[model samples]
Target chain A: MHEYSVVRSLLRQVQEIARSNGGGAIETIRLAIGEFSGVECTLVELAFRDLAPEKIGRQAKLEIQNIPLEAKCENCQQNIIITNYQFCCPRCNSQQVRITAGDELTIIDIELREVGVNA
Target chain B: MNQTITVNRDLKADLKEQANRFRQRMSDQGTLVVNLVSSPGAGKTSLLQRTATKIGDEYRLAVLVGDLATDRDAERLKPYVPVQQLTTGGACHLEIPLVESGYERLNQSDLDILFIENVGNLVCPASHDLGEYLRVTLLSVTEGDDKPGKYPKMFRTSQAMVITKSDLLPYVPFDVSSAVEDARRIQPELDFLTTSSQTLAGVDEWCEFLVRQLRKIQK
Candidate 1:
């Protein structure tokens, strides 16, 4: 349900970024989606595929890179690598941990052809 | 030669910034904003109505209700306080703009507290901070005892986990203690309250809690 909202914002950013750059035909939009971003990547991809054709970046390709979660234990100060949402510290079995990675939702870069540029 | 525009923008972080601005505004106005989230039919409105009955006059209170459509909840709550409904049309969660606009419409100069009842959902609402001084997530017994474990996102983020519909405990197999235990495991500092809207058993207690929070803010 919220995937639509996510796509709408993404598209808005795409247009704004393109406009700021004096306009461009967005060739590829790259995104880094973290594991704990609370957004379903498949849903976002579906939204982009459905809505983009009628709006900005009609032929833009969406490339997503999934970021795995990493946490720092509050007790032992150890960096614990997570795989399947097991948040507890592996060494000390402490639950007090701060998530350091894999919760971001950010656009990395956009490959675009500048206006009045030859193919 | 080719060019790669390095423009990195984060939307979720932007939402957090918006929510922080709202919080600062509320703090400057000396108003306590509390956001309530729950599943559909989890007794959020009923509890609010019951609280209104018990202590509606104790403070200057206003409500902003969000749903997909309809002002039905607003109508139910109008008698007690200034209630406004925000129909999202189809958005599962109420974002910062909708909430800010709704509160701005109230225009109550001396309002003491504002309650924003989020669109009934456990998943979507948990992620969006509506600049609430307090965030409460409700769970009814009929929904089952494993809700906290199954949906940890809502429980993990909430300041308090309210167990509503306690009157149905006898008819249903919901364990109040176990539910509290499960939620506390995820959030050890989380406050727990057992309430029954029909009986109004915990209504006064919850009302008192709000009054206390309001008074704390004033001091």
Candidate 2:
């Protein structure tokens, strides 16, 4: 799976952010993963577990939020929660639906312990 | 002390931006980049072989073929066009960096078209954009008609779907219309074309499609 590579990118971004914020010990990484993002949450967590300990520390945890596939119909302007990967609008049966959300892997926020805070 | 940092960012945003920049650069050079993706053995190289024979004389074309290992595809298209192979070394997808390096190796800036034959996997390739002007997904007749519905992400992200191995349609259970219908459900404006590189059927139409895309970019 490509989740390992994706996690590597995620860790790189996290490391950059941590470094910019005074080189703290990363504690929690918050992420939002969409249903249609072509990523498996379990696989991502597995990859994170395998790769994060050495880079981000052993206690760092991933908090993942699963986002459902949602779209807006261009014809009738009806908001829809897509089911079974059907992209057609349910209200108007319009095929001209545009995805409003649920197609991304976003890093929402992160919690870090400031370096030398306990020192 | 514990501190929280709000860093709202899409993971792929940087990659997408890079792809867009590449697209603009290629557009300025009058190069139509076509990313061809499909399952392994879905006639990607075969179609390219036919495409090279059909339009290689009319256009300055090059190919960057991605595979886990092996330069066999590049060898297949060598007689027809300038070809480079980007071996991912086990990666399931061809990312932007790989595409850029492959393009540099091709070393032809005045190309009319650059075709990237992506690594043969429908899933991961759909997630990574290779700065292509046109993203075409190929479905061989032997792969069944229900693939569009099953692999929704791949079909949804693609602009066009090429039904390959049309010569084997009678032998296989693939219903072209049903596959098109299913794909169109996810992508209403998706274009569809059927061809067989073996029989050379619809090869001219495919070449014309590329020509039309090139003209669009030129204008």
TM-score of chain A of 1: 0.91
Worst 10 residues of 2 chain B by lDDT: B183-192
Best by DockQ: 2
CA lDDT, every prediction? Answer: 0.84, 0.94
Query: Which pairs in model 1 have colliding backbones?
Result: none
Candidate 2 DockQ, CA atoms: 0.86
User: Which candidate's TM-score is highest?
Assistant: 2
- Which residue pairs of candidate 2 clash? none
